[model samples]
Target: MPTPTEIRLKRAERLLEVAFDDGSRFRLPAEYLRVESPSAEVQGHGPGQKVLVSGRREVGILRLEPVGHYAIRIAFDDLHDSGIYSWDYLHRLGTEQAERWAAYEQALAEKGLSRDPPRRRGG
Candidate 1:
């Protein structure tokens, strides 16, 4: 796995900038990360059991913690902290961002959902 040489969280831009040892750099949006979280809660128990996470267009990373030597635990602003993203998974998310994002959008559309959650009228 290509280890990250640099990792920066651009709070204002809601982006996580990661530069790998292989000279590859990725600027991943917080919303994308939130929706594509690798947690069992999101990814499910096995293949084809994946859940489509919607209403995450405005989600952001609240913090990140190292998990031993293999992955990082991401705490999202929405209180989701189960996903431990490994180097390999992060790399794949970056490299295949376009395709993944497109599929997400399609899934949401098919389910009559949107990136933004429906707002409650009274609370």
Candidate 2:
């Protein structure tokens, strides 16, 4: 497996650029990362329990924390920071962006969810 040589978070664009040692590079959106998070909250404890996260089109990454030598913890602006994105997983996400995103959108549509966050009343 190719290891990541650099990871750049473009705050303005809400994009995460990952470059691997094998000359393969990918630019992933923050919304994609958040919805497809590898955390239990998103992936669930076992098979067939994955949560379809929605309303994150405007979500931005707050910070990236190193998790030892294998992964980094992404703290999203929405306050989700539990997912520890490993090198392998990030690569997988980058490579599988299209299929995964399509699936996510389909799932959301099936459940009647929107990419836009719900509007507030008083605030």
Candidate 3:
């Protein structure tokens, strides 16, 4: 597996820049990470049960906790802190970002969902 060499948290840009030992790097966005979380809350218990998470265009990463020597548990500002992102998974996410993002957008459109949260009634 291609292990991560470094992870730069660009909080202002809401991005996580991860570099793997194989010379591949990915700038994963906070919203993408939150929606593609490996946690059961997002991935579900089995296949064909993946949930379509929306209204997270502004979510941010609160912190990242290392889990053993394999993965890291991400703590999102949305209070979701269960997904354990491994080196392999993160690499795949980075590589498949374009296709996955396209699918996500299509799913959202089919479900009448929006990436941005609902607007507040009051000022």
Candidate 4:
């Protein structure tokens, strides 16, 4: 398992860049992280109780609060400030981004949901 050495938020790109001591780097999109948060509100108290969060297409990072040396708390512009994103958790999320995103997309598809609003061209 890789340990994070530093974390930087690129506000303009809406991405969180994490550098691990093992020379690994992950650039996670803010929207992705916000939707996949590990908070109880999203994960619930059991295995099959995870909530599918929608309407996060416009969510942005409001703040990143360090929790000692192990974790950091992310505050979203949508008022989701409960999830404490630990280094290990963040690493896992980064590592599993593709698979997780696929699953999320699949779930959304099954539920007739979309990640973003429809785009209008030349408007």
Candidate 5:
């Protein structure tokens, strides 16, 4: 498996830029990473249990912590921090971004969902 040689967090762009040892580079959007989280809440315990996450268009990473030597534990502004994105998984998400994003959008449209969450009343 190709490991990341560099991982940069582009705060202004809300992107995670990863450069692998294989000379492959990917700029993964915050929304994409949030929706495609590898947590049980998102991925579930078995196949076909994948949950389609919505209302995260403006989500941003709060921080990213290294999980051992294999993965990254991302804390998103939405308070979601369960997913542990591994090297291979991250790479796959980057490479298949287009198809996955299109599928996500289609699913949301079918479910009458929106990327931006509903506005809340005065607290």
Candidate 6:
């Protein structure tokens, strides 16, 4: 069980860099994190209640507000600041990003949604 030693938000790059004590670092995109937020507004109270977040394809982090030493609250450009991202949760996200992303994609496919807008093909 590795623990996060530091978490830094690169607002300019729209990424969150999390470094663990075990010398591993992960850079998570703001849009991905926003869509995968654990807040009730997004995740709801239990399984099968996740709200598909749209219009966040261009969303970015405006700022990172530290909540003491336990967590960091991310303020997004889309005005979603309700979720408090904890260090442990962030670490878990970093570790499970691949699986979580795949799951999100599957869910989106089932619902006929996409992370980004469809591109127009040449005639």
lDDT of the candidates, in the order given: 0.91, 0.95, 0.95, 0.89, 0.94, 0.84
Window of ten residues with lowest summed lDDT in model 2? 114-123
RMSD of each: 1.0, 0.8, 0.8, 3.4, 1.1, 3.9
lDDT of 6: 0.84
* Cα-based lDDT at residue 68, candidate 2: 96
- Which pairs of residues clash in candidate 5, taking residues 3 or more apart in a chain or in different chains? none
In angstroms, the error of model 6 at 92 is 0.5
* Models sorted by lDDT, best on top: 3, 2, 5, 1, 4, 6
- Model 3 regions lying over 4 Å from their true place: none
Error of 4 at 103 (Å): 0.6
Candidate 3: how large is its RMSD? 0.8
TM-score each candidate.
0.96, 0.97, 0.97, 0.91, 0.96, 0.85
Per-residue CA lDDT of model 6 for 1-123, tens digit only, reads 666787777877889999988888999999889998878899899988989885567789988888887778888888899888877888889889999888878888888887774666998
List model 5 lDDT by residue over 1-123, tens digit each. 889999999878899999999899999999999999999999999999999898998999989999999999999999999999999999999889999999999999999999998899999
By lDDT, the better pick of 1 and 2 is 2
Residue pairs in clash, model 2: none
* lDDT for model 1: 0.91
lDDT by residue (tens digit), candidate 2, 1-97: 8798999999999989999998999999999999989999999999999998989999999999999988899999999999999999999999999
Residue pairs in steric clash, candidate 3? none
